[model samples]
Target: MSETHNDPLARVMRRYLRRSGIIHLPVVYSTEEPVVFTQPVSDNVLGSFCSVTGTGGLFLAARVIRDLVDPDKDGREKK
Candidate 1:
């Protein structure tokens, strides 16, 4: 299978977590927003959907990293 056919976010997350010495816990993102696409279900899961839809991939990454870096501070307060 092609690299893009696989879950890039999951792969990146796995590599990052492994490097950070977090091997046991699996990360999950709750996607509450609706997606407009007509791809196969498996191809439409997780980051695949975001890539295909050109959606909030960067925003999600930034938000997650921001939360990790300065979680106690509300992000909106800076705006």
Candidate 2:
């Protein structure tokens, strides 16, 4: 999959992350074809799992990096 930096959504996400003081980690945005398995699986369950594993993982990683950078400072204003 090719990386997309010009996407509007990516720009918005990057802006938000910067505002939240998550500047250390690089923000990478990419698109890929959805890999669906034709099994006896409910759509809701698969969707939830992908959402958590994909979006949740980014936030979790960002939090960890931000804490490691400067745990005491609030991530609102830049220093």
Which 10 successive residues of model 2 have the least lDDT summed?
A: 25-34
The most accurate candidate by lDDT is 2
Lowest summed lDDT across 10 adjacent residues in model 1 is found at 1-10
What's every prediction's RMSD, in angstroms?
10.3, 9.0
| Residue 68 in candidate 1, Cα distance off native in Å | 0.2
lDDT of 1 by residue, 4-72 (tens): 224556667777877888755423344344456686677546745546444456655776788799978
Q: Which regions in candidate 2 have their CA more than 4 angstroms from the true location?
A: 1-52, 74-79
Which residue pairs clash within candidate 1?
none
- TM-score for predicted model 2 compared with the true structure: 0.32
Provide the overall lDDT of each model, using Cα atoms, as 2-decimal numbers.
0.56, 0.62
Q: What value does the lDDT take at residue 39 in candidate 1? A: 62
